[model samples]
Target: MRTSAPAAVLFDMDGTLVDTEVLWWETAREVAAGLGHRLTDADAPEVVGRAVADTAAHLIGVTGATPPPSPPPPTTGPPRWRAPQPS
Candidate 1:
């Protein structure tokens, strides 16, 4: 008889195998404070598991960064890539 390899492999990391949740929370708080927005425990749920870019965008909005320009009229071709705004 021959044995087959497993069909899938899952890795448990971060909060599952290691306790880095607090570290993440602290880092988020520091970043938010540096950006001039106070982060509270009440905001933890939303901040956790979010990408850095997403969080930065949120900070930009909260810190009164310039509003994005209105999109140009839609066209029929493939979408274009806009350069990321400076943080």
Candidate 2:
């Protein structure tokens, strides 16, 4: 039996193949430090598994910085990926 080609390939950049959570945590830590906030292990849960925007908001809120301005609605923009074509 032959298998069909995949229509799309998903990448689990969070941790399945590559553990990049540590890098995210480090970046959050760095940003917190810049804001005069000390990031602790307790922050890992909120920072590591979250989107960067969420983490930034968390940091800013905790640091007592003025809330960020609301952004325009999201756009579909360009296609992020294209499936491989049969050769």
RMSD values for the candidates in order, in angstroms, are 11.9, 5.2
**Worst-scoring 10-residue span by lDDT in model 2:** 71-80
TM-score of each: 0.48, 0.66
Best by TM-score: 2
lDDT of 1 by residue, 1-87 (tens): 998666555544357777776777788778778767788867776667665555556656666655457533543356476445545
lDDT of 2 by residue, 1-87 (tens): 999877777877769888998898988889889889898998788888886667877887777777668843443367676777888
Local accuracy by lDDT, each model: 0.64, 0.78
What residue runs in model 2 are displaced by over 4 Å at the alpha carbon? 1-10, 72-79, 83-87
How many backbone overlaps does candidate 2 show? 0
Name the top lDDT candidate.
2
